[model samples]
Target: MELPIDHFRLLGVSPATDGQTVLRTLQQRLDRAPDQGFTHETLQARADLLRNSADLLSDDRHRTAYEAELTALSAEGEGGQSAIPALEIPNSKEVGGLLLLLEAGQAQEAFEKASRGLQPPQAPALGSSREADLALLAGLACQGAAEDYRQQRRYEAAARVLQQGLQLLQRMGQQPEQRRRLDLALEALLPYRVLDLLSRDLSASLERNEGLQLLEQLVRRRGGLEGESDAAFPASEFQPFFKQIRQFLTAQEQVDLFSRWAEAGSPLADFLASIALTASGFAQRKPERLQAAYGRLAGSGQAGVEPFLACQLLLLGQIEPAQALFEQGADPALRQWANEQGEEPLAGLCAYCRDWLEREVLPGFRDIEADPDLEAWFADRDVQAYVEQQDRKRARSAPLHPPEAAAGAGAGTPSTQSSLDAMPLWPGDPLASGLAAPSQPGQSGALSEPLQPEEDEDDWPDLALGWPNLHWQDLQLAERWAQLRTSAAELLAQPPSWVLPLAVAVTLGGVGVGGWLALRPKPERGQPIPVLPAPDGTVQTGAKPSPAATGAPKAAASPGAGAPGAPAPTPAPPAPRNLPLTVAKPSSAQLRSLLEAWLAAKAAVLAGATPEHPLEQLARSALVGNVESQRRENASRGESETVTAEVRDFSVTSQTPQRIEAEVTLRYSDARKDANGKLIASTPEGERRNTYVFARDGQTWHLAAFRASR
Candidate 1:
């Protein structure tokens, strides 16, 4: 019987290859076949075909005869005009019609037809490599669209496009090679997406937490900084990225997050511990944190340690020596920073260093909790908003021109079914950067008739993955650095008296407020800051309310570590009615009382106080379990918080006879103290939207499941 896919092509070996090589190749393929997410029948069929091909190719006499048949089959196949000569094209006009459009360089039309064909009624029209080919076409179409989004800096949209394609391909897992192609393209977005998240404004704790969580997930998947050597999309350098993002987070927040990671001995232990110590040293004005940081980096010889050490030295107001050390390193960012200093030297670099640590250094690192009124100040002159608005317009724009209409050299050329076959795969940048391989004679459409790919040792091209498919870029990182430097220069121009011993006046610290609220809708603040209703039922706008009025256990009264300027507030959630909720009028007072009681209990526990009488009875076992976990964590860290939970805007969405679903705006103010009872960190507030499923046990309502919004 004639082979459906030629044995040499299936094994991806030259016809002159020997039996030993064929067997070795077959074994390798069989080993990898199981993990490709193929269907059971497909796997079985593939296994049989692979074994048969190897058997037929192994014997010298049989191989000679097989090669003869393959040569004759090739001649017949060429007359048929099929690109993938190894595999028979399925007898379906639906598939043939789409392939023709793809060959014509109309990727969008090919993709649309393929998409419609994949639906229930049309999927039956496809089989074998042709089915996989259709899926590959759809994936490549997504890649083309994503590359456009990347150039426009619409990172989220680009990610969405890739993710949507991945979802579709994942469901059709029979074709492993095609699915793998899309996977690699999506992975390329890791750095760009993470950078965007880090650079975005810190408007809400929930938003910040979500970004941090997403970033961490990506890092963990890539095996963090240390283990990404073999990763398809290796992690971006974190030390400098962290340094850039740290300005948005408070010292307490930094310590709270990083210190926990360090203490837990996470994969990111050493670096995170160093950051925690650095932030703590400034927060507490304790030299011990610096000593520890020095110990962590001094002999570790980790990448970027020099820059980190230089930063520590700069923090100590060691100007000349630190500058020398910074310039010594191969860090592009530091070198550029030094060069920019020549333009506006900022009192000869001391101004920038002084602004960073004037409020630090020496002693008296008391938590003054200055807010800087960035909300009002940034609002008055929202330059970032204008720039971002322009960016949004650009992101939503149509392509500058249709796909490049070049031919000979094949730069930025699209390979559709109707188009000529591409040259052997280029080992350069994947499809996204429009980096074309050295052009050869024949070509095929990238998203439509991708078949008979050249499995080049350096670059795998089984499908016609055309230009404008990969989305990797420096992503204006240098531009961001320049912007920061410019901002620092402007800050130094004003505030002449900020120098205290080191000319450091702390331009922006502890608060990770990003460039602009208007860059994306996620961080925009359109509404007035929601006011928490006083525990006694009245709204508390200015003065700190009594324990009863603030929904705290009266016994845990402590000084409110207030902000110097008005506190930065989180936006309240949409009113309950605007949400798709089953609105029911439940006793508002009853829900409030239940929530306050739970908060009082929680605060008491964080303060290292015994849970008030009936604390166990006050909440459901699940809620109690979460509280106990928090208590144990704080205790392990030798720290505790005197927390005051102020709940407001409680809206009951849907309620059952045994339970109630509600959303409330909660502002949690904590004066975190170490085991010594000394106030080491007082962040003033951490607020988020709290969703509660208040499950009632017996007659009384109890806190059951609670989720803080991301």
Candidate 2:
């Protein structure tokens, strides 16, 4: 048979060519091929190469398997024996078998084979390079096994396998390359280890110390705190673990460790030292060290570091310097830190700084103007003359009654009035003719002058109509008689014949009646007025009876009832009804209390306190249903964790007789540790707002439902 062409060579690409390169090469070959006439064998070869190239380059698993198969085939074709003999280490056959098993995805078999390989005794004088290769193979096997465990969420098992592999490599004194690979593997595995430990009951003991040491090793392998290695672990990925470890150490121990690390010039050492110093109260006693630590952080030129340093400075009572720093730095982190510190002025200053930098500095730089001396330019005679000419032109071009004329009219001379002949007038106005007439010179002058009041004549008003003191009553009577005579004469002139007779008769009748009434005797004294009986058999009197005599009900006798004969007995006032009970909305004090109670309960649960513990009781009193049940379950599990919630503010959005709705902002933190007292995980401190529905159980408000939001 003709020698089979390698797919890579046929495709005109290297064996290591990527999928895209392979596809591109295949496309080129297809495009160049003839449309018709080709041999069957050639077509078959092309198809085979295309398929094999795609398979080898597309998927990692497939590629790895193919490569291994190719290696095995090459070895077999060369001879019945391999070119490179396996090293004489613990169970070398098992080591080879483990590699084969791992490549085939037989992880269980691989783990069993690796375990068997690790069981044998080591040779006394293995070469260093050979030993390192063996150790490297063993680590790969263990890593495969650990990955298998991890896929099943068996974290503890994974950690155990990794730990065993690390120990083996350490004993063998792994080569630099081998050690780097193993360190990377361990770095990936550390988080799982921490979680496993925290989930178990081995936190406060030697296992915690071991785990911490493992973390330190990983940290050191990544170029220690200075972060000098390109392969250094990401701070974001490992910062929580570092914080956790520090949480387990006392302030003094932390200070000692931080001091040592700082002396060694670790990058994060200053930050750690600051925390330790603050916790140990050394910030107040030996502020110089604090200052040095902050100085180092500030010098790092890292984002957000300045804000923290400024906050610390402010706390230490260095107000002026802190203020200056806040006004200078434009970091958003500063605002957050200031808010957390409850320094409103500092926060405001940081906000101002951010605004200034964004709105003024950035835009000003983008649109900068040349700085010309405006005052000096204006002082030049030509420029001044030009400006004056423009002003005069504008003034002259303006209307006689400019818009500003009304405002400044009183400040200058009055404008001359236009002649009435030249002004428009409405038709039929009474003053139209008067205004239209041409004025005489004297008349115009007289019209312009203000009028003067006429002088009063006291002599004429003193006696013209004044009456003398001589018999004023008699004079009045005589005047009345004269008026009566005049009236009588006028009446007689128009009177009919009956008028005089009727008048004489009326006069005589009046005289006769007066004489008769004068002669009649007047009835005197003490006669009784009669009372009539009505059809209803009640006595009726013309005058109304007094309230006391009649025994009638008074208006004030009964509330909202009217007295008899009162105007329509004003409709009785509407019946008094109780208003809907207004359940008092939860106040900040109440929300804060609830927050404290909840935090206390969560802390108790994390501390592994029994359900009957006082803290649990307090928690139960504050919480209900699922929340309470969850606490109990956590407590039963003996979880070593603590949570604290601080309520910053709350608003009651709605309320009813039985329930209330409120939005609460709380800063929350949850810390977890292993049974050996080594912290493994903790939530970063942050503010969260939750809408809570509180149900009223009797008089106390209990949390019913809550939705956490941004």
The best candidate by TM-score is 1
- Residue pairs with colliding backbones in model 2 are 202-676, 203-674, 203-675, 203-676, 203-677, 204-675, 204-676, 204-677, 205-676
lDDT of 1 by residue, 523-552 (tens): 111111112111111222355433223232
For model 1, the stretches where C-alpha displacement exceeds 4 angstroms are 1-113, 125-132, 201-210, 225-257, 266-710
Q: Mind giving the per-residue lDDT tens digits that candidate 2 earns over 557-579?
A: 11222224433322222322211
Sliding window of 10 residues with minimal summed lDDT for model 2: 497-506
Question: Runs in model 2 with CA error above 4 Å?
Answer: 1-143, 152-156, 162-203, 226-258, 279-310, 317-710
Each candidate's lDDT (Cα)? 0.47, 0.42
Q: Would you give me the overall lDDT of model 2?
A: 0.42
